[model samples]
Target: MTAAEGQSGTTGAREDERPALLRMRAITKTFPGVRALENVDLDVRPGEIHAVCGENGAGKSTLMKVVSGVHPHGSYEGEMLFDGEPVAFRDIRASERRGVVIIHQELALVPYLSLAENIFLGNENSHRGVISWNETMRRAGELLRRVGLPDPPRTRVADIGVGRQQLVEIAKALSKHVRLLVLDEPTAALNDEDSRNLLELIKQLRDEGITCILISHKLNEIRRVADRVTVLRDGRTIETLTVRENPGDEPQLSEERIIRGMVGRDLDQRFPSRSRYEGADAGELALRVTGWTVRHPIDQQRRVVEDASLTVRRGEIVGLAGLMGAGRTELAMSLFGRSYGRYEAGSVHVSGEEVTTRTVTDAVSHGIAYVTEDRKTYGLNLIDSINRNVSLPSLSSLARRGVVDAHAERRVAERFRASMNIKAPTVAEHVGRLSGGNQQKVVLSKWIHADPQILILDEPTRGIDVGAKFEIYTVIDQLAARGKAVLFISSELPELLGMCDRIYTMAAGRVTGEIDRADATQESLMRRMTVDRS
Candidate 1:
């Protein structure tokens, strides 16, 4: 954490002066078929931002639930000390009443309600069934400003974007007079600018002396703002490092060092090498999108993807670079046979033949595939087996006489598992048990196993760790080497610049400019992306 320089102590320091505001000692919890926590310990000072880092299924969320009273007291064998006293909470409300607030990764906000109503939903400022509207608005407005949200109290929750909703979560915590706030993957859905802004707000809150215990897969973000970082592996506390921003420090928080601690292995080779493209065979046209435009089906005036032209050919990876809401995903989804929005104008040609773009099935039949960003919601069925998700798009191929051939489905799943290097015990294993990166690979494997000529990857490595990202990159490059067209969209400029052969800069639903990979510097891309907005 860059807040200030403190007395140096290596693995998880505790001040000698006073008891921490919150402390969990030797926390042990077990669920069905898994020992989720094995004597894990954590502490949050009165005003410190203690970050928890780990791969998925690392028991980070389970420990937070233990702390925030979701697990209650007797169910878990642990001693939770808060405010120099042992407090056993039976429910979330029990914790909240005592100034503990937890904002989950999957946010809880009513879509139909206004910001003020959503802010004080269950705990309204009311008297005898009459809501005090003026007082509610005043307090909601204050909390919003504290969290740096630029929204009115009366604005409907569904009308605003996810970034603003994140700020609202922070505001909700603030409203609770929280002594300790737990945020789980708060910035996972935000763009670069919004992510930075949210981090700054977190710092500002820390300065105001509100303790924060945050869980994030983003190592760079943990390096940027965490006062202390606790690493968890296989449901245990591996090590907690007192993260300092000083360059002169012996253990600088570089990507290599972080990955080593997280995975307990040296990940020197991050991305696999790809073959250089030739003018004719390599960049030979596979998919061409010309004069493509789309509008919101209900809101006709809202043009989601405006007159955009792009081309991706065999063995060439064309990257789409833009900010969040710049229509990168919208454009990609719409072109996967117009599955995203109302196609007002456009023509899609696959290898000089006009391809259908009316429905998702038509797009799939026409040798086009799209991998949506959200795996839990759009990509995979969490409750189902991995075999099911991998065979979803091409189920008919594994069916015989309108009946699913279960053996054939298993074979297909096993084949893709080997090809994609998916780390699962069996094809029947639930996708919910896998890590973020593995789940992402499952999403990719599901699409690629369908044998698409042109692939559209939207934020392919959004929430995965470095190790998983490396694996996914290797698979993508291999696909390109075997002669497939790929349209890549990523918020990280460096990833796109490093991996893509060519790039398009988009802003406000339009492709503003194009750049070759050799010439696509981060500064150049940013300038192109933000030309007339200011």
Candidate 2:
């Protein structure tokens, strides 16, 4: 349908009169010992931005996969209707052939390929078995322009940032002549500016008569872009709310209402209650890094960190806030036994005693632990069971004569699983099969089980839902209450403001400013985080 047709067909119409471009009827899906979705129904109108909001493990992703044919026809019990025609697809390629495209959270583009090559990866422009490079580049350039990306077609995907890669994904979708686009967690890894740009691009797509289905955990983003929202809870459809259905008395949907539908209760407060530490009278010093400097591992002339110094006091949570690639993770990893960049110079002190942790084992032995940002790569062994992942760090304590006691390991893993509220069938379940939130809890459990007095958490709540974030915050609070020093690093400023006793902003490998909780504001922190390095 053209833009004019879409507007005139459904504009100012009653809810019953408007036509649904897509309908998922009586959908039900199941896994072993799990009913992922139970008789759910959804209706999405043409040219409208429809949002799917739910907590993690709520079956939102499954529904989209079913729609896009990732689950394939006859794999699940459901009927999908597109544009008044019943359709069943056997694979993703079949769905794409009918103009139904899905951009997964983890982008599918090959990093080594050029933007043009990645855009037309499988669907290349060819004439009589000959690939047409000119046609591909021209079409790729047009799609990039439509998505508002300024990068050239020849640019490599690996050389660009994540925000730009997301645009490339959208351009790739457009190349398929997508009539209905489904985006799963599109802005989960993007910063504020990139997220805004992406949302604007979605709106532009909507204006051009393309229908969109957005699955997001951030309620605020959904509210900003969605014309209607479908809320799911525990694999069931709770409600579908229109943005302007009520017409005037009040706004049709609010963030509070969506969250209530998601969590099945009024949150009242997004963050759990916690006591803030006062400066100078907070507590004794627990971990301190003084005169730290690190050079790039590959680039000997470049400095990753220079004379960086920070401290985490007992019973206090200190935050490190910075933009992407501001060297926060590098500093944290370098401090934890020089695990990252080459250590040029540094001094680490734990409880007033200088410590030399030249290796990961030495760092762990010195009562220091690091929960890495990339949990899948550096934190958890995905092929192993949760019990093993949680017990791996503390095996010595559960071992006798260098042989691990199986019963003792299970006991410790079960205890941490219960205490951390990890939602899994059993501690023996593979970590790879668990949800993102559960995997993070396992990582934390592994580090906490090691009995580290100084814990460094990098992006602890990165890809989880709001409820899971609150639970992790509670865990951090309990740790601080137990007199364990926490060095928290995050790209989210609001999280830092809510949980930290004090905030240190970094930019271009240098600490720009430090503000106490009482004095910190988003503006102040952003100013510090984006200071001109030149």
Candidate 3:
């Protein structure tokens, strides 16, 4: 049977009528000087997809950590029950032994290992203290097929894309014979098609009698698949709403209702108005690229970006839209000091003057700054204080007589902390302790401090919630109001439509089309984005 048919067949009864498969009561978790969760409660029924909705720092992850034993039993104050019996899990292994598995936002698979090895890393198929390779591969192949991954079991995990890697994570969970699967932001980094497939898999698992606890910021996806939603705000349970209505009935929950519960206020407008900047005379040409071409860094012969050209005017927010492998990130990274690929041909102009960006220093010197897509890896140092990270790109300006000036650095960080509304208590706080939204703010502050004329933001709001996205949108508008050229790259088409003055679509390493904001639609942009010139 098809996935949709299976889902429909499983929706005959209200899942709420069933007894709870897992439950938590009055859960309170704390850290040094931070109350992460307080009096939070949750419930999940068997054979249902339960969604957890919350803004960043709303204690969603903390609650899941408590349930999955990442926080352990003695680390917090809570009452938990699984299968009608009280349980205290000391670690992840203990939880897994009870058929409870959690897949974190940051995938835990080893990149260098084969898919089979990574899937069976801890729970190996063995007998007499020896592993059977043939048995392992056979079981791994069955699990992969179950998850719809066609790659060979011997394929290296690193060789596959993130969408397939997510499937592998589910396969790994299945290997443990998981009963309760908790996925935190599973589709946060996925493309539209991959996301749909993953959600279908979640439903398929539900039809097969596995319970799923889904934590996500995408309300639309929740509306699509979730049987019920539990909203958390400020580390407290707000309300639980039924999302799955009777068969052939209208939805009982709306996106606005979920937003209200999440933020404690109505978000009448998701994207802030940029009417003030609309219809204004075009400013000077700030950045221009012509006939840009780049080859794969390792292969040297395969072209990643080919004959691409675009321009951004001062005080304008232009967008780049494309699919996952459409070469949008490659073009942006290549322009930012040839960071991703070998530059074969290109000419860059700043304010109509030709310049060369051969290195990161050169790019910065030419008033260019790029906010990387993978922030945890390339944007900020997690262990460092927010003050240090905010001043990293502009350390030279804060130095006096070849010595770093501590006072100047503090002032800069403090200014950004207040202006950007970073939620940290002090600049001395480690960035790793902050929420996804706050960490993104720190990255923006670092580049804004460099005083760049042109900014390329890649997936700036990738993992943040709606409230935080609005804040980031306001910041971007403010940057454009200050006469800075902003090139926004995002996978969400609605975001591009709302925030950009114009958008350029890329497909197969080539520029497919450019459309003014007045004329752009998701359908039109998608048509261009799928034009595979290669």
Candidate 4:
């Protein structure tokens, strides 16, 4: 829809939810090649943590961007009513002028700068461009304290870990004198301890009378912090439920209930896997890492991946379990060709032969494939066609004299598209147009095309709906069944227990403990994580 049509469609959406602090009517957005949002409606009260829940591509982020002026007033088709008044935000700055602020999942923080500088980076408090550093630091410290950080504002963003970086982002939001706050997948990347802290912070913000619109894939956090919840699917609003009032007699909202509203149907399998990992112990180790110690690129003194040694045998599945940023991805990336950071010391062996992993090509030649956690950024080329992305990892093999063999590439992509069940109009469809679950399947197809002896998947089932998670698990099980080694990393411990033959725990950049699938429990892993917390 064009901007003029969107404006016309915004009529009557704010009537039913009036006396509401904010009302959104028939909001719709269209990208170059995708209809992101369609006829969506939302309302927010003064002091409620209104949650918007959906599958990764359920149009939650696009809706939020439309409301916050990221899409601009003239860009989307809709009417935004704030404080019972129709408002048009030309840009994010204009939204902020009305005390609206959004903190995205991938935080916008300058790593090299101090917390104070980041807090007031572009929107600085100054007179005629002349800065007041001392005043900025003082206010920044106060904002951090308000968010329960209690840290010095002078701390560099790069110095602290991801959990602390999140806190800094929250502090930055509070600095805007925000009345309405939007957070997209805020704790999707946080551990239990840090996740609780961020939730508590949200509750605190609610008590202070801030209207919050939280967009998250984690329903547990929504059940905890939000009083009212809204579910979106296929660019439409799927009934807003008062979770507290309805579930008042009950303890918590069940996954079945959430899935029912999400997909408009009952889903049987939550974490679906066709089969379990079972193999002979005598099999060869396809990939092995010995005494690997990796340091933080910026801090240098702080190690992210400690002296961690692990092995993936042929036809076996090994799961890596840890809190967010406990070095799960670090291990996967550094080992799958050292794509993460500057290495201190490590040795990678393939087929019992120690090999140097200095470049991506070196790692590829060694029969290794890594599917990154952030699919949008690292996994696939979003702008290209599905055939292109699926063929990228194995393009050289499907080429004739450095020129891409288009026919061969299509055959390869077509084969995996059927095998991996990637949903799209055609192989010629751009990856950017596909849904999140479908896009993730495309990434899996890309890796499978590479035909690596060992495969490492990081957060493979994240943000996907119940029906899709099972599909991905089945694919992983198939890989192990075919005598290929698989390395799985996930935050959900139950998944690790159910799918893996063995699981390893890492903390403070070191391998702290290991557990067999038969013997592992949630308590066992929790104990190991806090072993050296003191």
Candidate 5:
């Protein structure tokens, strides 16, 4: 039987075939006001790369937490079978002891610690309660080589970039003797080259007989490496699909089919249909930056962004396209009044008039709003309520006699929540408890409340699902319809080609090419992106 018919909830394989390495039967989990998972079931064959794709708030993370013992036994009702043996794991350590390891979406490494020390953090290389430094370093080197990381064992985790830290995380998992690995959104923050390397590494591990369960919103990555795919929607298992082993024999799984299963309906277009910008360039300049240069804060001699120039007209959705470390984020932050890096030189103009913005407050007063790429770190206060977050930027307007109007604040928050379609029971819920898509919407809402004529959005839909992406696109179109100058920066070229009126390609801190909507093609953008700038 094919792998597709090899699950309990969806289908089953022939009795003569090998037993599944893991079976999660009738998994039901609940929170105070949410049925996160309801009677969900899954099966994983040994030595296969199984992918789980779902919209945000679809209980993908909850199911993985259950399997990894984050939501321990008795907290949720489920029967788990590992190697066809019934097991109830009391905690994460118990699961790890049985060769089941999970790497969360946010890495769990100590930044100040060295790579070797992080690899064997709690499971150390010790003799008589004394850690053997030599052994730890040797093993760390081997693990690093296994994960294709070239960093030395002595290098601090904080010193490396996000991509390298991810590899080090996998090395840490390897140290635990992982047989079944669960990776949640492994490549969400990665660029093209780094994502390719990580996917290749997952495939390599699968070939070595390690069962992998990958959760990702990127359908292209899922289609690239998944042997079988299981999709969850609204906290329910939709279907299990078998991927074509040989592309020459049969076409791989189509993204359309997966989207249908995920959203429970047909989505004719991945991107919303926007009007073309062939000859529609008559509006006044809404935002303009000229000869913008920023240097690395720690090393003032090293310039990160050099002589970059761009402009956005009124009601225009402009795209900034590049690979990782192309100084896209740095430029955006620097333009938002030196929020990042040391601003060396730049001229900013709003509505065709020069404006002086030296800080975040100054930028806001000058009708500029910047939604950061890392929402958790720089955007929202996770511990605060949603209403508070939404009301933050507009507090001055909502204030009366030096006192905030709580009733008006709540009303404004309610209006935005309804308009954005944020899925939460109440505005009083903490921002941290929400899903990736909802959190992104909240960030946008916060900025929109500021009422900026010019807006900068960096990776607006980075870790969100396709459905959420469509909704975000709709929101952007609405913003543009309201005559806002939107500067959209993303690593996904398809997004730029679909949503933007014009695109500017950045390579090595320089704006290499600019293409109109009609002229923008993935190949053209990529060619400009990889141009030799030395």
Candidate 6:
């Protein structure tokens, strides 16, 4: 079929008046016992940003895999057309040959390699069998400039921050001459400033006539750059809504509308409402840290957390708010068994008793549980079963003479699975097979089973969808209601404002300010977060 013929058939009454650059019809993918996608249809026009929105298990990534050739042709039932021509890709390289490239949430770059080398690792600048270093550096420099990364091509990727690493991933994609760029949760790990810069770069790419497929849980970001959004629910395409007609046009999409299609229900509230706890009326202090100082583990001369002090009262959810590199995670990690850095000086008190938490075991024994921000890395063991992961922290309780009671462990896991609403057929299932939201629940269940009087949760709802976020919020509220002092740390200011009783802001390794819920606003928190008292 000719390009013009395909255009005439697909561009009927569309505002953009452009033919679909990519089209999929009757896509169906299935795992051993799971139907991941069922008759999922998607269309993308040239030079437009198309966003795919869905919950954690709604098959967003799976659909992208199908497009990117991660799931090779004939392994699934689908018909895909690129540039008005039927295409069947056998591997990622085959997709890349057609200028179709995908960047996953976890960046695929060699840490030890230089920027230029990483950018052209597989698609090297070479003549015959010899690699031309000069040509690679020259092209890498150009690509970096296009992505707004100021770092030199010779710089190692490991030396840079995550935001810069993301840019490098894009530069690598550019090296492949990517026409249809698929980004899965591109800004999930980025700070607000970095996220804005990345979004601006994406807009610039769209202007340069490069089509993009953005898979993100963040609704605001989708509304910002997407021309149209496709919502998938339970592995099926619910509807595709027009966000805007053109790049500079006013958006006609509401978050509520997109969310309704994703979850199949109207979510009246994003954050679950909790009972207010005022001063003096709040319960006794469950956790207190004073004069806490931590030096960087690698650089002993540098301080990551400096003289920080905070308190969390029983039944109260106190928020720790900060920008990236503001020492929020440093402080939490330092307090919890001094896990992160070298504790220079600090005093920890639990329920009016000064305690030493110099080790993880000591911290757990003292009734302090820390739920790490990186659930996949530090929180849960993905290879283990749900029951094993849930009972990990409290193994001693389920053990007799050092032999674990398997029946007791299963009972405990089952209780948490039911209470936390973990969507799994059995606790014997490996945690790796579960979605992001369910994996987070297992992490929480592990920590909660330890029966800690104080819980330090860091970025508990980072990458999950809005519906899953609401469920996580409900769980945190329940923990507080049970008189557990909660120290909630998050990058999102609105979340802290909604869920916290009091918020403490950090800047450059120091606590800058603290405010009550009634008095805190995004502006106030940001001001404190930017104002380094050093």
lDDT of each: 0.82, 0.85, 0.88, 0.79, 0.88, 0.88
Error of 1 at 149 (Å): 3.4
TM-score versus the correct structure, for each prediction:
0.90, 0.89, 0.93, 0.88, 0.94, 0.92
The candidate with the higher TM-score, 4 or 5, is 5
Off by over 4 Å in 4: 1-18, 148-152, 155-163, 246-252, 274-283, 299-302, 341-346, 414-438
lDDT score for residue 491 of model 4:
82
Which should have the higher TM-score, number 1 or number 4?
1
Regions more than 4 Å wrong, model 5:
1-9, 245-252, 275-282
| lDDT (10s digit) by residue, model 4, range 26-74 | 8988876567788888888777888887766678888887778888998
What is the per-residue lDDT of model 3 for residues 112-163, given as tens digits with 9 covering 90 to 100? 9999999999888999989989999999999999888899999999767665
- Local error of candidate 6 at residue 426 (angstroms): 2.2
Question: How does model 5 score by TM-score?
Answer: 0.94
Q: Which stretches of candidate 6 lie over 4 Å from their true place?
A: 1-12, 15-17, 112-117, 126-164, 276-282
Residue 511 shift from truth in candidate 3, angstroms: 1.3
Model 4 worst lDDT window (10 residues) = 1-10
Question: Per-residue CA lDDT of candidate 1, range 1-534, in tens?
Answer: 222222222333335454589888889998656688998877666787888877666788889989888898998887999998999999999999888899987668987899999999888999999999999999999988877777899998877766678778878777777878899988877877888988888877778888889888787888788877777877888776666543223434555555666788878776677776454676678999998899975578899788899899899899998886688878987887676778899899999898777988888888999998767777899888889999999898889999999999999899988887777778898988776767898999899889898999988987776766787898899889889899999888888987899999899888988999999899999988875642
Error of model 1, residue 307, in angstroms: 0.8
Question: Which of the two, 2 or 6, has more lDDT?
Answer: 6
The segments of candidate 2 whose C-alpha lies over 4 angstroms from its true place after superposition are: 1-13, 109-116, 125-167, 245-251, 275-282, 295-302
TM-score of 3: 0.93
- Pairs that collide in candidate 2 are none
Which residue pairs collide in model 6, if any?
A: none
What local lDDT does model 3 show for residue 343?
Answer: 94
Best by TM-score: 5
